[model samples]
Target: MKPALKHFFDSMGAYFGRPGEESLEQLYAEHPGWDAQRGRVAVYGDFVRGHVRGVLEKIFPLVRGAVGPEAWSALVEGYTLTRPARHHELNHLAESFPAFVADAAASRGLAAFVPALARFEWTDFAVFASEERAPERVERLTANPTLAVLEHPFQLCAYVRTKGARAEPEAGEELALLWRHPELLVTYYVEATPSALLVLKMAVEGLAVPEVAAATGMPEAELRGAVERYSRDGLVLAPGGGHG
Candidate 1:
């Protein structure tokens, strides 16, 4: 694309926020010969915003419900203005929405709970969409790619499970485990105990079973059982037929 055309599109992307009619008029004046019908531009802008909102709604329904429509719309609009979707796949657009919410909450003085809610929702979405692979044995486990662990001040997983009944932010360390079920073909979430969280962290860090056992001070047999259980449950990859 020519520099002029690139600039035009970038300028148009600004409309994804709250750009006024004057901005559109100015853009039309600056880029004459380009199709800039006000109605058409408005429709285009609505389409883009609607698409982005739909994706975010799917990924963060609880957040949307908690924030209400107006606030959610503003959040989405701000997100488009600041972090426009640059990926070829639209589904990947809201991958960073949780972080964006955190920043927005801080800057706007909105609810302190929104960020952790967003993170919990994004983790579920991410783990569901992540690619699945054959389980590898503990020693050969290089990466626990299919699972995600999120730590938050609010009990986000529990709150979400209760459909966001508790609106006020709670003060506590919450470890959320989002994973794809081994054979059910669906994603699931659970609150993790500290020991369970430690095991998962070790797995994600590519530690061997013995190494994990040593680090956690867990009995070797119990650690091996947990690893095997996760592998069978499809949360962890099966071991490859090789010594690590």
Candidate 2:
């Protein structure tokens, strides 16, 4: 590209990468050589920022509600300025948002559980949108392709169900399993027992029920029963006769 054209595009990039009049003024001061149409350019910048904020709000509505209006506004603006969306599709834009939220949580006075909540919400959306499919049958126990094991310090399942009415999560250590419903094509989560999580985890690690029983010192029949129960819910993909 010619120097003049390259400079113009570079200046516009700096301006559009951040929202607010302050960023615009900085751009003008830094790029005095270029005289782009300020008003027309500002409109486009505003649209990009607005669209990014709107998509994030839709994806993390509970996070917005928990933070309240003023904080939520600042949060989205800060996120846009720091991590501009780069994906061709906006659906993947918030892929790093949970980590971003975790980094900002303490400084923003957000509750301890907020980061985990964000992760759970993202996982829920991801699993629902995933193209992966569970196999029709397996010779042995197998973990569902869409299974997600979530462990956090809050009762996030109930909190999400309340739609932020339960803004403050009840304090507790919780482990939950989330997955896409094979037939229903929706996300579902259930509080997991240690045995249930262990069974699935072992299956994912390519261990059969007998191996898990031997390693954990549990009876093989008991472990097999657990696998059969989970198979009924499609959490475990067992053989043809194993699925209830």
Candidate 3:
């Protein structure tokens, strides 16, 4: 494409989400062809914006629903203006939405619950789309290798699992474990206790069972049982010849 045409299209894409009268005037001034086609350009802008909104709705249904239509529309518009889609793949577009919402919440003086909910929704979305990897025998525990751990001030996992019906926000720390089930080919979430969280953290840090016990003051027998259960449940890969 010609440089002028390319710039016009790029600016048009951005305008779809954040249309300003000045921008429209500038666009027409630069590209006289668009002046005659202002109506068409407006329609196209709305079309593009609608497509983006649809994709975000699918990715963050719970959030969209919770915030209501008007607020959600404004949020999407503002997000598009500030954090415009940079990735070609739509799936990657909202990768930073949780943090974006968190920042927006702080700036707007919204409740703390908003960011927590955003994080939980993103966790579910990420877990569902994450690539499935075969467990490889590594010399040591480099990471959890399967699960994604999220800590929130509320029981966000339960809130999301129940579709925000039964679970209410509680004032305390909550740990969520999200992982894909190998056999079932589905993502699952579970609320984990602090002890389980510690063990998993230690494992991810490449600690041995004895080291984990010493660090956490957890009984060796209990640690062994936890490790065995995690291995069996596919939270971690089956034990290799290296450190547990």
Candidate 4:
């Protein structure tokens, strides 16, 4: 009835379940209330949470697979509590949960791999959630890891691979990609450090095989082979990418 009460109830919807139908009617004197049905005050409420959880389940399958069911639910609950998604799209709802894993790792730092692993998974997701891709010179073949040559906003999706003497992937950490357009896809491409550079080349710098190989220290033959593999997979494409 009043703005204050309405606001309070709205906040309650987010925190508690929707006001119980009884409480809803009793408080607002409405004929009926959402409480009678389900009460998930999530940003997406019930169905959306299911959608997001499904997304998370798919994207973080290894996380679920590794952590197991009970632990997976705990991770999801903790994620929901600490980080309420701000994104309007259910597609991107799990965006920052990787950081959540990183934070959790702070205590034990034991499962350090979980951080990059989670983030790697998120990349594929961002690619799929983002709008259509622009033309890149997809019609070329090279081992250039950087030549992935995507357009901005779609470029590497804000994650980059780190290298050099100072940068080394810990045993637990992994590099991954997340993508979902026509279908949801997440991949864990295990490769030697140099091979991993091939992935970084395409994802981070958008370089084609030759260009990527030139930039990276990996041998030309190896780089070329890697690019061939990636390009064939649709992960790496002709220079003119995503555009008709």
**Highest-scoring model, lDDT:** 2
Question: Which consecutive 10 residues in model 1 have the weakest lDDT in total?
Answer: 134-143
lDDT of 4 by residue, 6-66 (tens): 7755554444223235533443343245454333333335554465577688776655654
* Tens-digit per-residue lDDT, 61-142, candidate 3: 8777677677787788887775356678786677787788887886665557777787777777777777756355655543
> 1-244 in candidate 2: lDDT tens per residue?
9997887667666666687789888877877765878887688888777778878887898988888899888778767766456677787777788888899999998878889988988888898888888776677677788988899999888888788796498989998888886666788788898877887887778787676788889998888788777776777776674322
Per-residue lDDT tens digits for candidate 1, residues 1-244, read: 9998788777776666655677667767777787757898877777777778788988888989888889888898788777456677788889888888988897766687788888888878778778865353445543345677788887676677788788765667887777876556567777776545555665667677777778768898987777666655555555553222
Q: How close is candidate 2 to the true structure, as a TM-score?
A: 0.78
| Ranked by lDDT, top first | 2, 1, 3, 4
Find the candidate with the highest TM-score and give its number: 2
Instruction: Show how many residue pairs clash in every candidate, following the order shown.
Output: 7, 0, 0, 33
The regions of model 4 sitting more than 4 angstroms off are: 1-13, 16-49, 83-86, 106-110, 132-244
Between prediction 3 and prediction 4, the one with superior lDDT is 3
Q: Which stretches of candidate 3 lie over 4 Å from their true place?
A: 1-6, 19-26, 34-43, 106-109, 136-146, 166-168, 198-225, 239-244
RMSD of each: 4.3, 3.8, 4.6, 9.0
What C-alpha lDDT do the candidate models reach, one value each? 0.73, 0.80, 0.69, 0.50
| Candidate 2 backbone overlaps, count | 0
lDDT of 1 at 15: 61
Poorest lDDT segment (10 consecutive residues) of candidate 4:
146-155
